[model samples]
Target: FNPKLRELILAGKTQTLSPKENELLKMLAEHKNDLLPRERALKKIWGSDTYFNGRSMDVYIAKLRKYLKEDSNIEIVNIHGNGFRLVAP
Candidate 1:
């Protein structure tokens, strides 16, 4: 894929994402249709796994969902206590 086009597809034309949201989406895109562990997200994005950070990550997840909803092929699914999966198909 073309580098610039890949960035455009990943980032979208709106270009309105918080740093955390951007990182989360980037990770999801990298692992598209695969599980993304909650703990892993916390450690990589929040720098730690704590109650407060967990809630904060949830907020980011919601934001990501809203942003990606325009595309029917894209979905962010919660896997109970396990984590999330970014499904594109």
Candidate 2:
């Protein structure tokens, strides 16, 4: 996690992320080993809890998962009907 550059370096490569993605990553990182409620994340990041926005968040989450997949110890688990938890070594 490069706080200054707001970037993530993995597998000896650097990835530049969009502002929304960065914010989402930050939120998950802040929550770390805790559960981040779906509605809460939606409201915080997209300013709404609409179904469309929820779907958008899911896309962003998928992107984050792809970015972090290089590390075997990192995972984003869905807590069906609830939220997500970011687990890291």
Residue 71, model 2, lDDT? 82
Clashing pairs in 1: none
Q: Identify the runs in model 1 with alpha carbons over 4 angstroms from their true place.
A: 1-13, 49-52
- Per-residue alpha-carbon lDDT of model 2 for 1-89, expressed as tens digits? 77457688888988888877888888888889899998888888788535464777788889989999988788888888889889986
Whole-model lDDT per candidate: 0.73, 0.83
Off by over 4 Å in 2: 48-52
Worst 10-residue lDDT window for candidate 2 reads 48-57
Please give the lDDT score for candidate 2: 0.83
How many Å off is the CA of 32 in candidate 2? Answer: 1.0
